[model samples]
Target chain A: MDELMEVLRRALPKVNWETDQALVDDGIIDSMDVVSVISEITDEYDIEIPSEEMEPENFNSVQAIYEMIQRLTEE
Target chain B: MQSIVEAVAAHARALPEKFCIADSRRELSYRGYWECISGYAAHLRDLGVGVGDRVVVRNGQNLDTVTAGLAIQLLGAVFVPVEKNAADTRILEIIEAVEACCYIAAKPMELSCPWEKLGDVLSFRDESADFETFPYPGGADTAEILFTTGTTGKSKGIELTHRNVVAVAENVIDGVEMKKDNVEVIPVPLSHSHGLRRYYGNMLNGSSVIILDGVIFYKKLFERMETFHATAMDLVPTALSALFRLSGDRLGDYRDQLEYVQLGSAPIPQQDREHLCRLLPNTRLYNFYGTTESGCSCILDFNAMKDKKNCIGRPTCNAHFIFTDEEGQKIEATEERPGFLACAGDMNMKGYYQSPQLNAETIRNGYIQTKDLSYMGEDGLIYMLGRQDDVIVTGGSKVAPDEIEDAAMQFPGIADCGCIPVDHPLLGKEPKLFVSMERGAAFDPAAIFQFLKDRLEAYKVPKQIEQMDEIPRTYNGKLQRKKLLELEAARAAERSES
Candidate 1:
């Protein structure tokens, strides 16, 4: 979880993310940011984040992103 | 010589049943669109929105907003369309600039300034309402005031006359070969000149338009395109690049159906242009060069000028372009001497709204000096260097970031990239390359620099290169080099303090 937060912090330097913040709804992040996050997570975790899994639900929050990574890694 | 409003009314009478504007919810026919425009005009008249009054219309890319614009013009009032999410401060600035009488919004915009909701505005809609249709105060009358993107400074309100709007729409019709049967998918905000002109062009030609707004929903956008059997698309370079990223080879699937694709507003990498050319060989791919103030002056038809895809082709329609030096003396178009591209044409703007100082500086002797730096080749094609302000002076040599960005984009792993001038102790300012690699592609600085070195002169190569997760851009996808420079400066300040 610490590593995930660290990766996200480096990827999105400007964003002050709350664990349960509505990233998309609040306009805290955008699609381009999502692309960058996906790339960094894939590179770090060595897990392929499929296009279908690229949804706001999995990426809307820090905790949501972490859970998505855990699920992808376990799979 | 009719105004766009007049032309639209003509279309309404000529093709009453034809679909004019549409979104996911429902579509409006020409007759319906005209009635709504008339209704909105009558309502605005009741609200004291008289001829030549400025009305700010908020809520972007909606059917009501579109109708309200025509309605405002139909009553001879000037409409100012702004982005829905624009800061209240910015909106206030615009209202002060124009001394706007009333604002038409979708809902209460939480603004101190008075505003009327679209619901209330439409409730007073009357189809049979009779108003002074004109003495058609459109030709020289200010029809719309579109604000500049303000990448460098405060946004300037560009006052476009009805004649300017009509000329620009006609230019689009001629340049892109728009027809009555064409259905163009427009995702660009209605607030900007680029998107609004496309809407007008389609309406003038009695064609259909699909309005899609917000972030790039690649799957949904393409799905809507397929559903509409959309014959055309107008977008910025970023959106096209995003589509390429999302669709990849599948983009070729729309090649047969899509008659043409127009890319404009910013300089796109030449490699991306060529990639698109190869991908959609059958579809007419155009890289148009124009500004909000000047309208579209040049268009490069990649299908026709495959050998010279780097150049923004000869002036289109009534546009006349001349390259000039710093003193504004005309410089002969030559490969060796790149100069600021200035334009004089029917489509040129009247002036910035309420800004005589800026107007005097920009619109001098009828030719508006653009920020674009370009030189005409021996073949008479204009090759764009980049923005004049974006030119980097490094070690006594000049470097255009467009050239560097073009070379960088050709690199296999590069997904997106931009170049900005960094302050140096001795050499003054040197360009530092900021790059975003392709998804899953490894970031290797040495290899990338090597690739750049092979393609460019030693002086043109950036002194430093850094890989970023994303490159910042304006809402319309223009590279925010100034912002990037500020970020780097802040980072340096932090480094020293630590």
Candidate 2:
């Protein structure tokens, strides 16, 4: 998860994704950021994220995203 | 002939408890919405924002933005809606340019101008306030001053009249076949002309709107649609594409629920149009063609014209066109030799705010000369060839960027691409291409060039192709050519320094 955050931070240096729970809801990150995160995770995780898992909840918080990555990796 | 304020008041009287609008925090019924408008009208009056005054409002999409905009119009003040997320200097520049009487923002900002936070005064609702008592403005009165996306130059504020707004409302309503029972979830920015016009039409039709912050919250947009039983929504093409790419076929689940989908402020590629038609077979897909200066005059129902390519449909009942040659003479354009597409109608803006030179250049013979070069096809529909201003002349040959970009889209390994003009030593100007590669795809420009060379004309072929992390686009989806040029200049400077 820490490794994933490092990848995310490269895209958005300003955001404190670790502490921000409402990233999408608060408009802290937008569609562009969402695209970068998806692109980064695709390369870093070597796992394709299914379309159903692209909802706001999965990307709204650091913990939520970490869990999603864990769940996908395990599967 | 009834004004929008009168129409809303009628809705308030007839369907007081009907859902009118909702932001992230609060929901308002028709009656409640009226109360907010009335209260805010009085509050703005108290602050000396009266008839014919200009108020600069830089606020995000929220309840205050919704009501205060109407309230400003209620008091006969011009509503100047700039992007809330715009730089403070730009916001201040607009305030100075408009010579605004007051500035309103969603949050506190350090500025020397007379300003008020949005919720501070606009939220002061007196229970006894009545919208019925307000003096109505004339049809010719300027209601809004919306800024253009400024893709090519400095953003100019377009001054739209009350008549124009009403005409646009009717056009969109007729174009999309909007219904009173419709619950439309609005993810488009309320501050933009497209969303503002949508809101006006929905209000006139007594339709409900769930104003989610942005379309980035696709989950909320879809969730609200399901929860409210929403039958409609609006999006720009790029945002729609982003959602389409991110979610894949999840949008297919709500096919039956969605009656119509509106795409405005940008063009929809033929591929997406066909895909959406297949995905939502029952849905009415509308591709809008208009600008801040002309409102939404041409709307193509892709569902109706499934076979037509590059068609933006005939002008609406209120709008008519005046195509002119390069010499400003009206000419009948052919498919091969297209004329400059110009618009003239009740929906056209009065003029740009304080831009005499631009007004003179743009507004000629009662028509606004659009950047688009188009021709009327044999089917008696308008077909845009490309932007007249955006055309690149390579070795004395006029090249449309759309042709190049469209060809590039068909090439594999390229996720996104745009064609912009760059300087050439011999030709003076040449076409330059930028592409963003798909994940794990190789940036093999030579192969892509070979592919595009076979597809495009010799002069139309880009002189240089560069790979970018992303092709920067304006919020509403127009290519940010200036940003790309700036980046190129910065790169050159870095190279020189190294």
Candidate 3:
């Protein structure tokens, strides 16, 4: 989860990841952005972000993204 | 001579039973349409409306607004249609600018200065025999005053004469091959040129017209089209984008019945066009380019889609175009140089209502100088390059935001994006990119920045990327760059406070 937060901080430094819930709702990370981030996470952690796992809830925050990555890689 | 009343009368004489207009409430035949128009004309005459007078029409997309527009023309009064329940400021501005003799509201309500509810103002108690007859006003008489979007600044009332309106309708019919059997479903706002022209074009040919109030109801719109067996339809790019995103099965069903689709107001993206073609192979797609000042400048047919997707095609019949540089010197069609587009034709409006300064700036000699930038292709087709006002100047080099936005939309995970010029003390003005992503997508700012860096010049790449839920849009669905700038400014202020 800390690794995911670090990655998000590098990607979007302007956003206050702690309080700004708009990361997803405000269309900041659009579909293409999500796809790009999934690929980046896959490349970084050597874990694939499957199409089925792509959901808004799974990408709500840095912690969620990290946990999802861990679960996919472990499986 | 080219008044809408005369046009309707001729059609009524030939095909009284033909479908003229189909609204949410009712469908009126040719004879019924003429009778209603005559009834409304008599009501206007009773209110002392005559040639050179203006009648403000405040109504949603209903049968009343259509008939009221025809009636205004029949009575030789300029029809000034403001959107129903518009802001008091906008309504007052329109009423005052046009010097409207009487304002007609769709619902029953008293308004300031000679305003009356349409229902109360016009009597519909079968007074057909007692209705007064209004003769058609000759050409050169003002027919309507349509307010421009005012995106550049203040909204200006564009005065379109009877000849101008009729000529545009004729040109559009000729260009698109609109027939009497054609049923045009209009989904744009009645206050804008797209809706008004589509309605009038069908009426001119005695073709059927269907009016849909709210355009966001795509499912309902598709159902209504199927129920009515509509042949043709007019829409803006935003509506087309929504329709493009629908499931293939649903799109297939609608495509099977549709004859042709027309898009205007903004340029339709190439991806949307290809998607539409794949879904509706038989239906012809046309992109119409025009402004409130110059009605319909050009019509890009489906065939032109092959060579260049963004080409707005050539000028319609009875219209001539010229490309002028910043120094106002005419430039020939070339690969590198793009210039401001100007047009001279019968479809062009007389001038802005009561604004000589705006009139002088826009209309010169015989041409209406369109502020849009475009370059002509070898095929003689015009390719629009974003608006001149929206051009971003950074480090003495001019960059169009559309090119950057277009490139960004192609990038994976980027749902939509807009580029705006942010104030930079050193560079004077720098480009800033604001992007929106689809739900559930993870975004990497570094990856996006790198992707854009590879695709665009160093200066063109946004110095900062701001993620947004949705890009702000104008009422017509065009990108609201000015509002986006405001959003960026507000964010900067918040950051400074912190």
DockQ of each: 0.14, 0.29, 0.02
Q: Positional deviation of B302 in candidate 2, in angstroms?
A: 2.6
C-alpha RMSD between model 3 and the true structure = 11.4
Q: How many clashing residue pairs appear in each of the predictions shown?
A: 0, 0, 20
- lDDT (tens digit, per residue) of candidate 2 on B1-498: 455776787888889999888765578888888888888888889888889998888755767887878888888999998876677778888888887888887555666667777756445766676656788778999888987767777888889888988888888888788888887777778788888888888887888888776665566667777777888888878777867876776788889999998888766654666678888998988887888788788888888788776678878767898789987789999877889998888888889888889899988988988767888988878988777767887788778887788788777778778888887889978888999988799998898889889987788888599999999878778777678778777877998899
Please write out the lDDT profile of model 1 over residues B266-353, one tens digit for every residue.
7776777788888889898887778888777787887778777357897888688898988788988565668889999989999988
Q: Per lDDT, what order, best first?
A: 2, 1, 3
How far out, in Å, is residue B468 in model 3?
2.4
Interface RMSD for all numbered candidates: 4.8, 3.4, 11.7
Question: How close to the true structure is residue B371 of candidate 3, measured as C-alpha lDDT?
Answer: 70
Residue lDDT tens for model 3, B28-55 = 7788877777877777788788888888
Candidate number with the higher TM-score (1 or 3): 1
Indicate whether candidate 2 or candidate 3 has the larger lDDT: 2
> What's model 1's lDDT at B422?
85
